[model samples]
Target: MSDSRVNLGKQHPAAYKALIALSAEVEEAAVTAGLDPLLVELLRMRTSQINGCAFCLRMHTRDALKKGENPDRIAVLPAWEETGCFSETDRAALRLTEAVTRVPDGHVPDTEYDAAAAVLTADQISAVAWPATVMNAFNRVAITSPYPVGG
Candidate 1:
């Protein structure tokens, strides 16, 4: 018999359930922290896109649309620095999103941190961090699991 391990979805039921539970907690924290849900979804989508996480990008793109994020902005997310589609708050959040997701290059620079902090309250910062952290975790899972992209 072959010795290859099965996929997580097929082999590890309990871990999958735990991930779902942790995701719920992250969502609750984002909401309770007074974050704009749409913005949180946008951040998730952007980070997922950067990480090439097809599962999360698909999931969060739908969630962002549901919360009334402009389709135009969603289309232009990869070029956020060049577009005027996002508000100052959104730009700040996006900067933080990039910093968090791309971190080992250097510490999150003070300029990005200060910009995000200026637009977002302490609670809002926490809220944004939750989604960033969650997306990063999900990215790793998808990457390692070699999850398929298209059916």
Candidate 2:
């Protein structure tokens, strides 16, 4: 089969625009919920990583770096649980992001939800979830469209 694929964002501009609007809203919500901007980027990156969305991973990774996220933290993001680079809130957000990204694995388990609840307020938890949700949708679009990840 040919590698050619329709760019979903361009193929249906209205739907893509709606998604973009939702992303902007999510960003505002994240900020209003008192989530650190760096943490928001990390959540986006982690969700992209889990979905194997190279297009998104590259974008969010660059965003994270531009926000002054430590390179070491980004490097060890996949193994976040094993590192001391993240704070309690960061860990909670990461765990929730993973659970949200891997929903088909078994859905978000009680352990994950409870863990997040233990450290994050209701607003914070919702903030983490919305980014993960938006990232997952964007990942599906980019992956299905086979968005090019140029060097």
Q: How would you encode candidate 2's per-residue C-alpha lDDT over 1-151 as one tens digit per residue?
A: 1378888899999999999999999999999999999999999999988898999999999998988999999999999999999999999999999999899999999999999999999999999999999999999999989578898
Model 1, 1-151: lDDT tens digits are 1236356655777887777787788778878977677888889898999898888898888888888989999999999999998888888888998889888879688988998999988877777777788788878777667466675
Residue 72 error, candidate 2, Å? 0.9
TM-score of each: 0.86, 0.96
Q: Evaluate all candidate structures by whole-model CA lDDT and list the values in order.
A: 0.83, 0.94
Best by TM-score: 2
The per-residue C-alpha lDDT of model 2 at residue 94 equals 96
Clashing pairs in 1: none
The clash numbers for all candidates, in the given order, read 0, 0
